[model samples]
Target: MNTSQEQAEQLFAQSSSEMQADHFDTAEALLVKALNMDPRLAEAHANLAWLLDRRGSVSEAVRHYELAIELQPDNARIHLNFGATLAELKFFHAAEAAYHKALLVDPTLPGTWCNLGALLAQNGRDDEAETMLGKALALDPAHVAAHFNLACLLLRKGRFEEGWHHLEFRDWYHPAEERLRCRRWKGQSLQDRVVLVMCEAGFGDMIQFCRYVAVLRAQGAAQVDVLSHPDLKPLLQTLDGVGDVFAMDDDTSASDWDYWVPVMSLPLYSGTRLDAIPAVIPYLQAPADRLVYWRQKIDQLSPRPGLRVGLVWHGNPAFENDAQRSLPSVQTLAPLWRVPGVQFFSLQKGNGEREVKRFQATQPMTDLAPDLKGFADTAAAIEQLDLVISVDTAVAHLAAALGKPCWLLLPAFMTDWRWLEERTDSPWYPQVMRLWRQPTGNDWAPVVAQVQAALQAWAQPVKPAN
Candidate 1:
């Protein structure tokens, strides 16, 4: 008869194989059986936690991680896993302590160094993050997360040359889209060549980087086609120098294009520098008919409103970083309601649209989201607004592309790479944007107060500053 320890080891080996084959359900069952046989099996608990985390049972995973750490106090890997779970839960300081402890237990672990470095970078500790990431790279030269983290740190510091170079390693983290089979564009001659530029990331990223379509044309590309989300097709068609906007689901052959490039790579290939950003205003246009329709709708709804201000309080909740990037709710935006004579239009979409009704009784705002079909409709509605005040979302990008004034609300931590660091103005939208940053630990009161003051000033009649 096999001893309990020997039987548990066999079960664990079988579970490892199941997990490697992507049979998560079987793997989980086996892990549970193994843990029952050997209650003190720390590795079994750790493996189960990883599977649970992947399956979105984060709270359960955290419990398992805690149990694993308790069973094996000196296991550096378990500590590292515990740190990752804590970070995911937004327990930043505790996560840092866990990472530090893991490093102390095993100074040679490159991954621990990389995770600690990335955590530091997210919290805005640049110098120490650089040192930690550098140490990770020294230990394992090909560590992708270390390279990506270092790239972001450099970019934040305005070291574009080195940053872009390091950014090329992002493919290791997320490989470039493989559907398009064509030669990749590398800033060489585009004369008489047809280049397909793909929108590889989020909606905001697409809007921000699609300006490069016009830049590609200026570089003598004969035809510039775009493969992007279907929702953007209507609006992208209006962008300058774009020819034949294709939906991402299109089964078109790449044989038609001489080369292709990911949209995110455009800034790097365009040789963009901080001082020389392609800051041309009004690169996108709303449909004339839609613009007229929205204008009429707003006029009939609020016949003699003083200032029409559009507000977006939340972004897509499914986004991984939504905890840091998104706001609590429209309820937190009460300060904006206090600014008299300013008519608030709810430009918020998704599940958050219901939030408007919650405030409508007391706040008295117009909800424009129900009639808005897609980005084209949103763009048209934005054109009619006096100003757009939004949390970081596609609407802000839409306002920027339309060359309309926008007040962009940013979180104190994990603001996007495009926003860079510190200054109020954005290089991408220079003349048409203002930024309001949240304080650390998810505080939005200060940012809302700033916006309230600015809105009051904007609503007033023209007066020269002394």
Candidate 2:
């Protein structure tokens, strides 16, 4: 016969194993059972809280975290995990306080220092962030997260030299892609060489970085091919100096290439600096037929025609930071419809499409999404529009890449590293873009108000887009 506490310990260990095996429900049940036998099982409460956080039961997770802290006040890891959850929720100050508490409990924990540094960096505290991250590295030189966090901070501050050097330690590439057969290009001579530019991260990342292909051509590469998401093939195929555009699922022969490099690494090899960013316009183009087709469709659908403006209110919901990056709904952008002489076109699909339909009774906006299949069609529709107004999604990147006037709405927190620190203009897009940032945490109304004011100004006969 085993003691009740011993039984609870066994269940706790079993729950951890179940979680490792991806049996989330089973693990949760075992954790609950363990806590039933021994209510003071702090580890079980902490693990259960982490599971709740993953499933978005944030209130319950917070309760569990608080209880776990009550049960085990000295548990540095519990405090650390709680901080990570708070950070993800964009509760920045609370997360920072939790991290500090963890550091006080155990100053030796490198992840606490690393997490605190990353949270600080997200909120524009670069100097303090660097110090915290440096302390993490000092405690343990091989800390990967500290190295990567510092890299992003440096990159955000336009300290490209040190940023790129530390970026080499960053590790989020597909293993198979990393082991490609061809020699990796490292700023070597591209004269008469056939090189492959492999897609690295996200849709927006690919679109933003694909400008590197032109840079390679300028460097004397004879033939440069690209591998990217299937949806981008139609648009990227139209790029100048690109030999072939194919999907990762398509047949690719490794022996035909002289050198291959990840699309992102191009800047490192090309020796890009703050003053030397390549912003040549019209790097991407829609097919001539599709462009004509979309223009005719737009001419028909937009009944109250004036200045054509494309609107994208949302992005992929699966993104970890989607809660911070994406809007609440298409209705959230209802203020834009009030702008006179501007024809609104809905470019949103998937997650928030219902909100587009919800506005049918009150508005005369054109729904262009159902007809848009992939990026190529989206690009075609965008080319037909005079200006594009979008959130920080791939559509914004596409519009900017097309050399069209784009107004980008930026979130207040976890504002991506690529945007750099607070200037209203983007160097990557140069003359064709404007950035409107939120005045404070997660409040987009004032930002939208600013855009509404600007839109009213833009509608003046003097500044017509066409």
Candidate 3:
């Protein structure tokens, strides 16, 4: 090789090593230097793009990947990387074009196919996505990422049984493998074992999966321990068959335990049938003191006794579909204001308070959340309320578990597991809950109108107590 070519190769090697070591700044500098020395260095540009993508600078990464593709338009890997980054940014159309270009250049690139499938699935093209993902798996049977992505696609399509089966392949995926290596206790038999169940995902996921604790115990697990977020710990501790429950920082490994299960997977292991779901009411109990305090607070608020309505307008902002699934507090409260003689209390938290203030300006509403703290306080308040009217949030789960009447307002394409598909009730929250699904995607107005009518009808006969 020529001197300049050899030097470029050395820089590329050194930059690759630094990137592997996670010294992104140094790697980025070296990669840029190499590119400056040889503008035709597609490998260096690709490496730098990968590093930037890993650092969460996806837009910058996309620029670099575009440059790399310009340098070597036939490079399937560069096209695939650029496509994946575009998908992350929700630039679905661009991502699709990039993935298509990659496949045209080299159809054998399974990662590109899998990602293309995922993007297709996200855009409501499930059949095509499934076909693409199947092709990816056929290309490489051991491709664990393809398996996991396919599982997600199937889950999105509401094929839970097959979905969960393929989801087990997540252990072989890169990021999931690192997370799964945490200290886990495994036992031959569950009968005498103290199984520690850990919460792996979001608050809604924890709530959805908490239903499995009893199923695990019934499956011959002698004792069940749960390591969950502190906010959820108090309520989860009251669950039936839960032996020990603590926050994530608690050292459950120090105690005697036989096995560990992620909360979400309990249903698969226990062979939980839809009919056999533990629908026991008040599975989660509030602390006595907290309950008494909330009761007194409600009494002081002098809320009209009949059909007390608790309202939550926002969910965690970090959730991918939060903008589509959640509503501004004022919009949520607008319909509830039309319901006469029903007391509307704010169950909203976080920045939701701003919207609550706007709603209170036009309606007679009470803020019950200011003094209310974590899930325990929320649970206590839900217990006191006659019903909870909420968006897709942990409060909805808390209310359902507490056996309070709950109206769950859902997006048109709701979360995979909610699976109502335009139904008025959720089989998951069997008792004391009704679902109000949006008729069209990103349209909350009609759903709110329905809620207004329902609440008005519900509050008709009940006069405010003297």
Candidate 4:
């Protein structure tokens, strides 16, 4: 090779090694020096783009990736990286174009296909997403990420079996192998083992999967212990078959449990079906004293008995689609305001004060949430209310678990596992909850209108007995 080419190759090798070591700053510096020596070095530009993307400088990464693509237009891997960066920046259309370009350059690139599938899924094109993901899996069956992503898509489409089948790939995606290892109990017989069921993921997921505890016990688990968030311990302990309950943060290594199953997988292992779902309501009960206190508080508010509605118009701000799924202010629920004799109480928490203030200005509403210190208080308040009108949030799950009626407002493209494509009822919450879905992408008006109609029906007074 020529002297300049030889020097460029050496610098590229050194920078690649540094990148692998995660010395991102050092790798970026080396890649820059190599690019200066040889402007046509496609690898250096791609490597620099990768380092910049990792550092969260997505715009800068995009510029470098575009330059690299210009230099080596046929490089499928560079196109994949560029597309992924664009997706991170929420440039979905551009990202889709980049993925398509990559596929055109090299149709058999399974990774690029998977990236394209994810972009399509995010953009609410599930059918196209599924097709691309299937293509990816056909190219490489054991591709764990493709399997996992495909499972998510299927779950969103309400295809439980396929979704769960693909979900089995989660263990492969974990960075640490130890995190994937299921706790096993060695027993003289299968019936003799004490199984500890640990809850992971979001609170809603834990609530949804907690339905399977009774099923696990039926499978002959001698004792079923539960390790979950501290907030859930008080309520979960009341569920049948839950022998012992401990906080997740608590040191459970010292506890004597033979086997452990992550909550969600219990359904898969036990071969649970939707119809066979244990429809036991009020599995979680509030403490009597707390319930009494909330009842007295509600009495003081003098809320009418016909339709005592609890309102939660917002969810956690950190949630990915919180801006779309959750309203910024309770005033957005103006339809509910017009429903006569329907009393409203705020069940929201954390940055919900502004929304409460907005509601007070426009509607005659009570703020019960300020005194609600934790999930325990929230549970107590929910027990007192006739019905809960909430966005897709932990509070809705809490209300449903306690056997209270809940009106859940869902986004067009909701969380994968809710799985109600266009239905008004949830298989997860059974009789205690009703669903109102958005008509189009992120539009809450139609859903709110539906909830208003439901509220009007609920608010009609009955005749008095002689």
Candidate 5:
């Protein structure tokens, strides 16, 4: 090899070592230097693209991927990475073409097939997705992501039997979840034993599954301790049958617990069925002082003699499915503003908070988000509201956990499995919660319109006694 080629190869090797160590900045710098030295280094370009895509620079990654594929057109790995970046950017057609090309180049790539399957699933092509993911598992039986994706698809279709079984692959990907010193509780008798239920996934997931703690105790667990997110500590403490609650990051390896169980896994072992869900409402409660303060605050404002409604337009932006599940802005909810007598309070925080100011002049909605420190705070505020209208956020779960009247505005495509399809009410919290699903498209207008109509009827003045 020539001197320049040798030097470029050395730089690429160094970049690979840096990447393995997760020193992304150093890896990126080395890849850039290697590419500058030899622009035709397709592997370096592909690796750089992968790094950029992982770091969320999808457009830049796409450019690099295109260049890499141009240099080495038959590389299936390049095509797979390119397709993933395209999918992240929501270029569905381009992504599909890229995945097809990858399959044509190398049909045996299990990861590529899994990626294609997931993409099809996200686009609502479920039958095709199932076939594609089945092909992935046929090729490599232990493909964790394929199993997880298949499980999600099955659960969404309400095929709970197979779904719960496949959902076990989740622990394979998140090994930290299974790094317990104690044995896994597989619904074994806990007559004289303590059980540690570790919280997993998002705030909404924790809230949804925490109800099982009481069930565990009822099933004869002597003591049930929970390891959960720090933010949920205050609220989780109020739950019945809970012996102790520890934060997720707190050291618990030294703690004495006879067995460990993931909060989400409780359903499978406990034989939780759709018909037999522990629908015990109000499993969570807020501090008395906090609830009183919010009640007094609402009384002091004294808006009108109508329903007090809380609104959340967005969820965590960092969530993988946030693009499909979250509303673009509070402006999309404009129709709700015209419902006379009903006072709207903004419970949204972070990215969409500025939109409240934009609409405050015209809509006259109160912003309560600034004072909401945690789920406990949100729970207290929700206690004072007559109803909560939310966009698939953690606060929605908080409202439902508090057994407050909640109306969830859900996106039509790729909705959460917990909501299930073709259903308006959640079995998890029935009677108090109603679902408003977006039509099978990207538009939120229909959802907002339906909510507006419902609010209009709900806000109708009561007929006075003659």
Candidate 6:
């Protein structure tokens, strides 16, 4: 190598050390200097592309990625990362081509197989995804990501036996799981034993899985305590066949319980299948005081509440697919406002709450954000309404859990596995939940039109039979 090439390599080494310490800006600067010193350095271009990828500079990342691949066409790692960047940008065809190129270069790469499977799954090609993911596991059986991805695919297809088993490889164990010092529950006899159920992931997950505590109680657990999200802590106190609910922020210890298990795992241990889910409606209830408070509050807001309906159009912005899952704007739901004799209340909290104000002047839907402080408060408000219409969010789960009439709007793009393959109804919520999925990605118009038509029919008063 020439003197400039040697100097560039040194700078690249410095960038690697800086990256390990999470000095991204310093690493980026070093990488740029290195690339300047040796314009033809494929390694420098790839490294700069990666830095740009992480920082959301998509155009620059793609430019460098293309340049790197051009400089070193046979480098499998570059193609893999370039594929990932393309996938992130929703260029599925190009991403697939890139992934296939990587595999052709090096067929033994299990991670590449896993990535291809995940991308195929994301695009709704389940059969191809299954085949690709199986190859990944065949190459590397203990690959955590491959196992986890395949588990989701199987679970979505309603193949629960192996799905539940493979789901354990998610490695969801927290620091607290270790601190418990007791054996993880493996569907054992819990007669007269104290058990702690730890919450994992998000609030939607907690609400969906908390029903298992009842199954635990049925199995003769003397006390079933829940380590809950503080937001849902008070609400969970009303959950049946369960004991105390506490949050991570609370000063609690592992010594307080016997065996511990992740809340989601309750299904696996209990032999939950599609044919037999623990679908008990109204598993969660509002505190009597809050129910009464929300009832009067609703009456005051809408004096003659003809056909009461709740609406939630947005979810957490931080959610990876929020743009696809959420409606374009609050105005997107303006058609529903045209439904005669129906009163609308906003159940939307966080992120897009401000959008509610814009609709109030023209659409006149009552905004419920100011009064809702927690899940319990939201649960109480939901009880006062006849129906809830929501995007795929915690509010949908919350309403379903409460046994309220909930019409869930699901996105076509990478639909959540929990909903399973679309059938317009959910077994999770049974008779109470109706699903309205977009026909294609970012296409909410048809779904809104259908919901509006349904709402119009729904608002009509029932006539007495002769």
**lDDT tens string, model 2, 302-410?**
7544888888888898976777778887777778879889988888878777777887887657889999999989999998888898888999999999988999988
Query: What overall lDDT, based on C-alpha atoms, would model 3 receive against the true structure?
Result: 0.77
Query: What value does the lDDT take at residue 442 in candidate 4?
Result: 68
Clashes by residue pair, model 6: none
Once fitted onto the true fold, the runs of candidate 1 whose alpha carbons sit more than 4 angstroms away are 1-3, 55-59, 172-176, 462-466
Instruction: Determine which window of 10 residues in candidate 1 has minimal summed lDDT.
Output: 172-181
Lowest-scoring 10 consecutive residues by lDDT in candidate 3?
172-181
Error at 114, model 4, angstroms: 1.6
Top candidate (TM-score): 6
Model 4 lDDT tens row, 191-300: 75677777777787787678777766777878788878788887777787778888866766567766777776766676556555566887777766678889899887
Which of 3 and 6 is the better model by lDDT? 6
Candidate 3 segments whose C-alpha is farther than 4 A from its true place: 1-15, 25-40, 43-63, 142-144, 156-158, 172-189, 274-276, 328-333, 357-360, 462-466
Query: Would you give me the overall lDDT of model 1?
Result: 0.87
Q: Which numbered prediction scores highest in lDDT against the true structure? A: 6
The residue ranges of model 5 lying beyond 4 angstroms of the native Cα positions read: 172-180, 249-254, 464-466
The per-prediction tally of clashing pairs is: 0, 0, 0, 1, 0, 0
For candidate 2, the per-residue lDDT at 194 reads 92
Q: Which sections of candidate 2 miss by over 4 Å?
A: 303-305, 462-466
lDDT of each: 0.87, 0.88, 0.77, 0.79, 0.88, 0.90
Measured with C-alpha atoms, the lDDT of residue 172 in candidate 5 is 34
> Which is the winner by TM-score between candidate 4 and candidate 5?
5
**C-alpha-based local distance difference test score of model 5:** 0.88
Between 5 and 6, whose TM-score is larger? 6
After superposing candidate 4 on the true structure, give the runs of residues whose Cα lies further than 4 Å from its correct spot.
1-61, 88-92, 122-127, 172-190, 303-306, 351-353, 463-466
Candidate 1 residue-wise lDDT, 267-338, digit = tens: 889998878788788999997778889888888877774898898988888876776677788888888888
Q: What's every prediction's RMSD, in angstroms?
A: 2.5, 2.7, 4.0, 3.9, 2.0, 1.6
Residues 1-466, candidate 5, lDDT per residue (tens digit)? Answer: 7888889999999999999999999999999999988999999999999999888788888899999999999999999989989988889999999999999999999999899999999889999999999999999998999999998999888887778877877763256656677888887899979998888888888999999999999989999999888999989999898988998678776789999888888888888776788989999999776898888888777555778999998889898878878898888888888888888898888889999887778886898888888777889989988999998888988999899999998887789887888899998898989999988888998888888999999899779999
